[model samples]
Target: MKQFTISQEHISTYPNPIILKKGEEVYYGKEDTEFPNWIFCKSISTRKSGWVPKQILSTPNNSGIAKVTKDYSAHELTVNQGQTVFGIENLNEWTYCKTQNGEFGWIPSYCLSST
Candidate 1:
């Protein structure tokens, strides 16, 4: 499975309550049929696994410029893995982005690739 780094600090909305930090790479776990948002993945650094929002992810080509990637952040309105986010401003480490739902927050710059 593909891995993505945390774009901002994420307090898993699921169990184990492990605090995920910005830049931590989490391996993709199995998808849940019941809840789409609370899917699980294991952490490479901490050796912990739990459900995370599908929005907080991006690929090498993660499309805002590319596909998104970074791991976690302390922003409110955290974007789900595959959600399309609009950049409000490009900060060096964290880029301020707004979700299509009109939610605003910070996503890590490493997550976005140059298109």
Candidate 2:
């Protein structure tokens, strides 16, 4: 695990995140213009939608259906400046982190610094 300090405050936009399992099918949607390599996807099983890193998604067919290449949770943690977190995974410029309070979610890499 890597330790990091939150350099800037980050608020999670999505409360109910989309959780996906490996080999699960999803409906691919538009890519985020502000964040490159992140795309909006709707899970076929739960019908929940969230931004997912493109790295974990398999190539989509013409109809925009794709398989998840790995298990992923789209949860985002609301962090404040000066807080510390442990990074669990890094993908598409975002870091999945665990807070001292036992909360886990994703935060933008730019908002964190190595501690």
Candidate 3:
């Protein structure tokens, strides 16, 4: 049982995404990964799917990346306040990241700081 903490806020579209903030705790799901420094995870209470950084996770490797969620659906993510995200792919302005609830979407880069 590993716990992950959010360093900042991450907002995603509801019904398909998640919103997490600093001081929040997340549950590590699978270690098998899709990208380096990224791990599959879920929100402790809401059960949202997303990806978190390996450095921030309690264990180095203990999560799995869900490919279905990584489809890079609608641009519904807004990274803010020094949030750390497992970057799967990146575009010029938007970045594909796993949501805390296991969803992938495009998020802005202005508000992110690598952990």
Candidate 4:
């Protein structure tokens, strides 16, 4: 696993994240203007809404509905500057990571530095 240091503090926004299984459907909303790679979506089954990375969402039609290409969790980890984490995956401009306490979530790539 790749090690990284948190270069900036990050606070998780969503307490209850949107969890989706592969092939699950979601109603697409709008793309985040600040984080263009993420789009707001609501799960069709759960009706839970959150910001989901566009990379995991299939192409939407005119009605703005799409299927999830893979299992995903819109979970973010809150970390202080200089904290260490292990990278699990990289998607859209974020990194999925596991912290020392065994908590796992996504952090913006810009806030991490290879250690």
Q: How high is each candidate's TM-score? A: 0.38, 0.94, 0.36, 0.93
What's the lDDT of the predicted structure labeled candidate 1?
0.50
The clash count for each model shown is 30, 0, 10, 0
The TM-score between candidate 3 and the true structure equals 0.36
Taken over the whole model, the C-alpha lDDT of each candidate is: 0.50, 0.94, 0.51, 0.93
For lDDT, the strongest prediction is 2
Residue 41's lDDT within candidate 2 is 98
Ranking by lDDT: 2, 4, 3, 1
Kindly report which residue stretches of model 4 are placed more than 4 angstroms away from their true locations once superposed.
none
lDDT of 4 at 49: 98
Pick out the ten consecutive residues of candidate 3 with the lowest summed lDDT.
64-73
How are the candidates ranked when ordered by TM-score, highest leading? 2, 4, 1, 3
Clashing pairs in 3: 30-62, 30-63, 30-64, 31-62, 31-63, 48-101, 49-101, 49-102, 50-99, 50-102
Model 1, position 89, has a per-residue lDDT of: 63
The window of 10 residues in a row where model 2 has the poorest summed lDDT is 88-97
Give the TM-score comparing model 2 with the true structure, all chains together: 0.94
Of candidates 4 and 3, the better by lDDT: 4
lDDT of 3: 0.51
